[model samples]
Target: MKRAYVLVTADKMSIRKAAWQCGVPIQTLRDRLERGVNQARPLGGDPLLSRSEEEGLVKHIEYLAKCGYPLTRKDVINLATETAIFLKKRPQNAGNLSKRWFVRFMSRWPELRLAKAQKLSMKRAKATSDETVQSYFQELDRILTKYDIKNKPHLIYNVDETGFQMEHTPSKVVGPRGLKLNAITSERGPTTTLLACGNAVGTCLPPYFVFKGARYDARLMAGAVPGSKCSMSKSGWSNGNIFKHFLEEHFIPFLPQRKPDDHVLLLYDGHTSHISIPLIELAKEHKIILFVLPPHTSHVLQPLDVGLFKPLKTFQNACGARMRESPGEVITRYDVCNLASKSFLKAFTPINFINSFRKTGIFPFNPQEIDQTMFEPAKNLARNHWQTEGEEESVEKGNMEKLNQFFSSRLPTPKEPKSHPKKRKVSYRPGGVAITEETIILKIRKVYADGDDAHIHPDNSLGEVSGEGRKRANVTQEESDSDDETDDVCCVCNKFSPDGLNKLNYLKIVDWAQCDLCNHWVHLEFCDRRNVNDIRSGPYRCIHCVSLEE
Candidate 1:
């Protein structure tokens, strides 16, 4: 329309000719000409921040997100409030930062998005410290250079598994304020694991899915991609056997034809199953070199974990949501593979694959890609430890004694309660089995009630009671004896002797770290020896039950 008006006014063209040539109305062209150079009016009212200020804000938020501390909506609103106060632009009508304002604010910044923050434990955070990441890169660089696989983009691949819930609830929804709204979902079901493999150059192999069942039905693969395969596992998790099967059956078969001498480099996490003899044997037989990521550092190092999986999960949820909306549809295990196929097609793009590799410094090797700020928390903690030691050393012995004296004077002394003697004698049952605290308490009550057979022995461990004992009156005997297990075993080594007992005096003192996945305790030292690194900073898995991931 503007072009037609320009032609009519500037080129001496008639209205009819201009309208016919430019395919616009003559009156519309005339109106545009009269209006002069049409300017795009700002849709909403003047922005709270100027263009430069908004740009700076976007940069700041991005920086914070990179620093592992993405701001919440409330945090962003507070920051805006602070900015308004700083700029002396307080509007009388404005109360809290409006939701619409935030929506518009995000619209202006396309690259800046609201993402669900990944929660990291302090141990996990420390595990991804700057030094650890740099070490990983150094080792990766050495390995790539050593094997001359640095330029082998196609040969360099990352494989990771992710789980998709049958009824994947969307992250956000619209609802009225101050009212409860539950997202209606299908029946509760187990997640299906999807094993995805991709190269640094953006080539993706068909996904391998593991479902929880004894047998897989053909209907499960109905809408799946042509070459995709599905397997069944008891827990729907991958084990060494499944991993070996995937490498031999799916992975090796999907690779592009190459010379017998040409080998591929496969990068994966330090899951015990991945390092098993059978998996290693299969990889070696197929001329695939397995490079295991350092323990607890997959979040930053693995290409699939760093980038691809997040989008894949989001897309899967979207697919599940679409499936759910169909009338009378309830998502079952069969529907997941199809939903996953749709998600993989949408999310596993070339850009996502390549970017993940580049960002993690795996391909086109560059260690500087990882920011130093990611390791700040670990460094700060180390620094504070030494500083705390120095301050403790600076304190005088005399001052410490005086402080102790003052605390002693102020502290209330606990008094012993009066005991009621009875004719009943408590009995001692001797056995290798644990005599429950409940049994002892019952015998004590029997003695106090003047029961003749209840005799309390002086050698009994629970013979004495204190003033604080009354506080535990409501505690059940089973609850009291909960910690008296004589046969606790380590999940990894499956041994009992040094497993449950905690004694610092032991020559080789061992601490038990519970697997987050299986909720079974394994010896910390045993985990270290077995290369199970996440035991310390965990959401961990035992060797036998390590994730196939869903």
Candidate 2:
């Protein structure tokens, strides 16, 4: 108990007070505190039983617990009876136990031990970039960039294909404006695939459609060839099957039928077939030049690689609109073939194909300079209100005045101050004259194919500079586009602005337009804004893309 007094005194109290509060005499507490030792309780004279009997009782209690007997006074009594009989044979203690019976004991007690304390070491490490293997393609890309085509125009074919499965992945989505906070989102999907192969001068080598069946194979590849192993994989989407089939079939057959000297140059990705043994042998034999782009560079390098796929997807979704009544919505192998035919035909029709490519801006040069855009959610450009089943145009809900007022808030508007007037400037230069134009031509810089940056002068006047020294016009959309609707899309990415539905006088940041199909901004143009042109472009997010390249 004196040990308890020390603990009490440790909490900001005198030993005398602690002892007093603990109801122990100061002298007794003082005697116990002479050393850090706890005293066993003093024994009183036990006239009831002897010490040997009490020890025997403890042993019996332990025996009863070990024997699976429930602890009770009766159990202890029976155990003691049996133990006493055993003790009759051999008794341990001969000491008097008259005073031992005065105390009580618990069955179990906790055992304590000392624990060792130690310290641990912590260190950090670094790693190299994960794309070490993929970089080899970059060198390959340089070789292709310099390699010339066999024929000037007609014989040069960028023959390639693509594939897809109907699967959706978890993707993060964003919300519209005006929320205190916007959370990310996810969605499920319908899917499709398109394969486009064509030449540099806007001629298609014969596009293929992607299907899930086994119609694609080595023989398919052989059929795609004219007579030799090298041919267009346009027999089907760019798959392992078509990859093999092209080397086996159409590749060499598609060679110049008329001009023996005419050779075909194939610009495609590094799919297995393009580099496979069969295809390689055919190329060497037939002198077919195969140019496969670098890894992660296809969307920016190939013409159809960017924006044309969106229309293909849109077409698939159109086909998928048919409801499935049974376990099969599977378009038959034949149906797939038919769909592939139609999709390729409609998607690659010369005019549509060129328009799509123009939108993507992959046509010219500087593949590294092209935008990487993924597909965007297709919006119905169809107006909300209609005249009736027979109506041709949308109903005008409001008057021109309201419409003008509504549009005024959407774009950067030219200002005429009502409360503040312009101040006259004081002459500072010795010439005594100042440049007083409200416009300044901003130079747009472009990267040339020769790896040099050149500036193109824009026709707009940069009125004032922001705090960051950046210049932008306060021009309204009505004044900027004047008569064109295509300019309503973003000039940087062909995406509708965050405030696009409401924002006015859309400003073009880069010299390009976004493809609605690809949903990316591309095709840096020198065309007049008054007569804007539409083109296909890939869209990139982390990187700008005309498609879901990453």
Candidate 3:
């Protein structure tokens, strides 16, 4: 078509001659020459959305994904449907855009692809920022340089604890398609805590086990590593006392002989159980440096969390599966030790220990080893909403405005903010601090001056102390009792009226009615009743209760 048009216009040839020379149809050539239009209309019905509208939608999708809120196939479909309605291109009765449209949309934009998103907690995502990680590395470098252990991989150690339940998580197995498959596991079991310590030089100490019981049992250590240490805790979880004991008894004994003044860098997360006056004092006494990773960053910064614990849990689950092959066998706390020990031996190899430290950028002291893309999710925390900048701004803004207006107008009004209980105040400590004699002395002074005996008494677990020297359990019980006294509060607005009168307007008596099904109190105004007589005339049911009946 271009050849025919060029021949007729540029070459000054007749329509018949140009069509004959270019092998084009005479009628088509005549029509094109007369109309003087270069491009022909696309060979199909018009698209539901214009090219600009589709481009805007694509930008919106990419912006959401970049903000760590990627849309699913159904989410895109619903979004498209809503967009079409807002633009008045589709009627409200039109259903969601089909999967075929989604496939074509993917093809239209080559940059987009379907992917499985990994789950990360909001706190973890927000905490794993470049600022937090860089600060941690800065402190870590100071400790390493001050102690002259940057070249000594044997002196750098990471300690962490993981839990193992008697009931194992089943792994995938070969089975017939379209048929249900089942893997046998214990019905219920108690969790056992395992504390592991490894160095950057690919060496590990004997695994330590903490079982749930008042008294320590010898049988729980059956089939465990030869030099493993076992202890009992009320909740089968390590506390400050257990951690202190592990460092003093197991960790120190297993260390290779070195000068008394040589410092060992012990890296671990800042769990309440991992920090105490006694633990800090012990570290100061021994030439060990206790370095805590930034809060909520263990998943990326802690060596054990980054590389070892995942495989350790997987291997433990496999071992538990084999043990379940025995008919009518129920794994006990005794079996947890055996299964965990097997997994620990497999996972805590020299190569794995070395890889764990390297992957976390700790062993080689290379802060640049961490991937920048891992911090993308945290970028959204610093911004209020996703903004399309650069070339996409003009294209996306108009459509986004319409869509936002449509949804905002129809969405229900937000509920009134409720008052939250006063949270216990905790003293903030800088991460990656090296516990030295001077630091320990300052901490002891602060504890005594502040009357914070929780840390001084290792037997008093963090959960027991309310940080204000009051029993946490007693405080919680009192709060619960106060909550029970407010049972007659309105469910809709959370307003309370003691004498059946509105607090805002005493003359306007607001009668409260209880739902017969849920037994929740509701204001007559919220129940679609103009007067208290209408509510008392019949048994009241809340909207949720009515929906449940349907």
Candidate 4:
């Protein structure tokens, strides 16, 4: 048809001759000529969105996915419907786009595809940034160079602890269609902690087990591999004392012989239990370099986590499933050691250990081994510094308006206006830090010296309160202040007066109302009151009281 149209326009042939030769209808040829080639349209009717609009929406979806916020099918439909309504292309009463439209939309865009999203915690998503991963590799490189052990894969070791539950998740089975299939498993069981240590050269130390009990039990070691160690913690998890014992007894003894002047690089997560004054001293004494991965990043940077533990858990579950087949038998902690030992032997192979180190870029020291896509989720977190106050306010206001409009159209009018959602406070920390004898020993000693602050805080291991805890402490301090001058501060904004005055004369000058429930004083503006007459009209309630009542 295009050829026919060009032939007729070029005057090489008549419209009827061009149509006959090109096997095109005469009416179609005439229509094409009248409309011009560039103005030709698709065979079907006009689409709901223009070509540019659809492209824009596609870009929006891609951007959200890159920011770790992928939208579902329904979310896309609602977004399209809302966009049509905003553009005056659809009626206000028209509901969201139909499933048929979603199907067609997916077909139109070849780049988009349905996928199952993996679950990742917000903390992990934010922590697995490029900056953090790079910093960790930098520190690791420095340690390897300083110790002159870059080529000595046997000297580089990673140690981490993983937990196994008695109840195993059942895998798929072949069964008759429409019939219920049941897999037997224990009702509930205690978790057993396994501390695993492996080197880049594919050598693993004897596994250590920690069971939950008041005292160590001899029976728990049944069916365990030779030289494996066992101890008991109150929660079946490793603590400072348990870790210290593991290092002193099991790790150091089983570690391969090295030269007296050679230094060993030990990589582990920065768990509170793994850091103590005694542990630091032990590492220093052994000429071992203790390196802690950045917080919440073990999933990406730790060798054991990147390769070994996952398969070990799979084998452990298979072993547990087989044991469940026994008649009227319940798997206990005694059985866990046997099951773990079986899985450990199969999973802790030389190839697995070597692959784990290579995957995490540890032994070979390649920082580029980490995929760039893994860091996309953290891009938004890092971009917070680039957003301006006006941009934030505009975004918040736009979201509020959209929500209010949606609710108003479906439900009855609300009595009171809904408040804005509280913004979550994200605390940032250093990308990574190396724990050396001189860098950490004195800090640990100072924390120990302060008797009241001796307890190890898990997030930082410095015995200091966390960000949320500090916020609570500040609120408590403000509430407990007995000074008369500070008593009249507004509870919501924490200001003395609306005019920013603390003088008693100014307090009277400004219209302040006290909450009848909490007896907290707040400014009239905060209470949604215009003046003293507004407060006199009804009982004044603070924002906090209103929120609680709602």
Candidate 5:
């Protein structure tokens, strides 16, 4: 009896606390003792369930109670009263299990993980329109409608430039490994430069500007092509400089020149260079109305942006690989330009380019007057090796022929015999022309107050006069080194017109010998460009520089 007392208190912590923490129901504790105390971890009486199962049931009951689920008196008893009873239509002869014990037993194995159960696939979101793209379409629609222009094929011209470098390109294409990835190495290869301009109607690819250097700047853009030739200035263009160059040199030329009743509309995407202040100003001056495509839609809207650039790239690579210089210098910008120019002639004939658009499937070309006009605007579009047809496709293949044909024709035409660049007299003060023992030191003490209006420069050259068309007085780099004495005379402030050049003394050809280095059958600076003279007095390396260079 004394040993049994320990189980009554020490064995069950909850029971012990329950007994003293709150005044015990005197009869209840005595009733539990008298009923039974057989479980290993004792509660006051029959728990009617295993300890693990009871713990789980406890959690479930608490959650349901907190969520305020309604419960009947019987359900409450089944939860907390621990009645180990089964009520499955039991008859009087069914074992010794009580109805109460079955209730507790059935509820014991609590399935807590299934508290908020449902199938995963049923939880997907309902369909809805994305506001992002919708807004863009709205804005675009407003613009097109406001301009009173229909959304059709040829009316819009989308232009841009793509680059081909001596290095990596995107896309995992299978090709001739050696030929596919050509770079400027010790061997010669075709350098590539492609300047392109296109719209859904079609693209205008002009003569590619190929040369020695690779770097492209505003000046180079202006120089290789004339401001007049390229119709260019201050800013860049779509495809960067490519579009600007193409538009100025090629596109505009093909386009019918503007007139008073013209209803032509020029549409483009807004690249930094395209919408530059200078470009805008130029557009205004040219009387052109430019419409810009919506931002992200250029992918879907622009014809060239969508499919043409890819094919354009393929031909550029093939042609560029063919331009090889024998192994010393890397292909320069001019080389790329040259290759690109050649590719332009080959890749974008009226037929080939038109065919490319046709193949793209989504092209908006229409047979209706409104649609077809985009492709063939003018009635008498030219036709020749250099001249493009309503659409012309070259049948030529390979390097020499493709390039030589396009390049030769694209070169600036030789000026007429009278339209040659006329030179103005540079007022060289003949400053202190002293004949010292061996050298001549001409230090003219003229006041170059602000160095403005003074042609004399640090290289001891006279300033340039604002000739007929160029802005900012220029010093003719060609004339500086080549002043000769014989057939050439300095007609105005002349001073022998430098060293080797045929002076513009008489508006005609002053027959001198040949330019040895350039081998141009004309007057050159030195007796022979091959000879090397001493350092103290520089030597004329060519027809003009032997004396001037010295």
Candidate 6:
């Protein structure tokens, strides 16, 4: 086009000659120099939305999708109509966008691809609140700036663990209509946990696999991923000891050597397994700064969780599928290593890690990546509307009440079954005679008295067995009649008195032990004996339960 312009003006060539020489149309050459005309060809037909306006709409749609709000076909039409109204266009045609307009709208935005929506838990969506995410990003930015992690991408790493079900969910297959009870061969097996660590530059450390067993199988490790390590746990889950060992034996060894003054930053979740004192101390020794992500916010915050693991799991399942296709081949733990190595190599590309870090607003430190809409779903439950034939109507009062009660209000408490007056164990098993004739008469009377609105508080003394109610039968005859208040019972020892009492109540602050799991209160002395090396300031659990989980 530029050559044609030179030939026509500077060379004084005819329009036809220039067109022929430049292989351009004469009309197009004429329009190129026309006064007060836009150089680019106008899009065919007048559009309801201008180019910039449509771009804005596309951006809004993308934002909603990022926040996990799926837009349906009607949603897009409504959005377009709303946009037209905002632009002060006549509402006649804009009020109801045609199918033709929708097709053209989609064609204009090539980047906006229609894909299946991913399900996000309401709890997780609520946890990723703007305030919480912003605070986390602020703290993360402070640390990254202090360490200058952006310049040293290799030194900034994210460590996360994920578990894979050994069996692959069956894919859709061609079958006759109305077919049911499809029998399919499967390789059902236990779960395996993979602990993966990767840096912003895309390099990943050797992954560690934790399996459920008392002993390690050499065969299982034979064909495993390159540089991958394997260990055994009772529950096939990562723990403080395993995490510490991975950092010491696998992670620290692979880290690039640095000067005495230099330190690397490692990001991980604040799970009990990842925050042990030994792991923290070991990291400090190796000049590794451990940064813990906020609780329940890993879905968006952690680089691995945000990017690497989903594809890794998909590829792992693909590998299993390929194995299944081969005759006489049985997928086993031994094959997981080799198959996983292939999947990891394909999934854990350097670009994925880098993009994940950027998307999470960690490497570049953009705190505003997440907005308020991420929490909108949880903040407001879906409104109910009654659809009759072809028209939508507001929900009726009764329907609205039922929906609101189901979603936002507590359920009605069930009436307790009656038992014999004499203290005895009540069998609640099916076919057991737990309710008596007298109790049935009282129940009928209460139901008739209250009618449909019969209600009882869930925490009422009559509804639930209180601590006092359970121990009343065990109290001594003389003690039961006494007016003096009894000491609080200990949850652990099942005793009615505190184990130790320092007479100087003014000088010492007495702290009662609270069990995080059971929510039971116990004597401080008993908890101290149970957890000898407790350092956590928040909720503390009994040693026996935590030890079993570990």
All candidates: TM-score: 0.55, 0.32, 0.66, 0.63, 0.32, 0.53
- lDDT by candidate, in order shown: 0.61, 0.35, 0.70, 0.68, 0.36, 0.59
lDDT for model 6 comes to 0.59
For model 6, the superposed segments whose C-alpha errors exceed 4 Å read 1-114, 172-187, 368-550
Report the C-alpha lDDT of model 2 over 379-452, residue by residue, as the tens digit.
11122321112122212333323322322232223244235222222111110000110111011011223222
* Best of the candidates, lDDT: 3
lDDT score at residue 199, model 2, on the 0-100 scale = 54
- lDDT (tens digit, per residue) of candidate 1 on 1-550: 7677668878999888999999998787777666764434443478977675565455556645654557888877767665665556766456668787888888877897787775654545666777777666776676677667799898899887766666555556679999987765677576567788999999999889877778768987878887998777765655556777788899989898777777788886644333433455566677777776665566667788778777766554555476557856777777777777887887889999999999988788888887666775456444422121122332336543333333233222334533532222223322211112234335434544653322222111111111221121221101111012111345444443232333444454455555554545556554434433544464655555553342
Ranking by lDDT: 3, 4, 1, 6, 5, 2
> Candidate 2: deviation at residue 393, Å?
50
Superposed model 4: Cα runs more than 4 Å off:
1-55, 80-113, 173-182, 382-431, 457-550
Best candidate, TM-score: 3
Clashes of each: 8, 60, 0, 0, 47, 3
Reference-based TM-score, model 1: 0.55
Collision pairs in model 1: 163-550, 238-548, 424-451, 425-454, 425-455, 426-454, 426-455, 426-456
The regions of model 2 sitting more than 4 angstroms off are 1-151, 164-195, 207-241, 255-258, 324-334, 355-550
Clashing pairs in 3: none
List model 3 lDDT by residue over 177-294, tens digit each: 9999887777555557788899998989999988887987788999999899988876566667888899999999988888867888898876544666668778878888888777
User: What does the lDDT read for residue 26 in candidate 2?
Assistant: 76
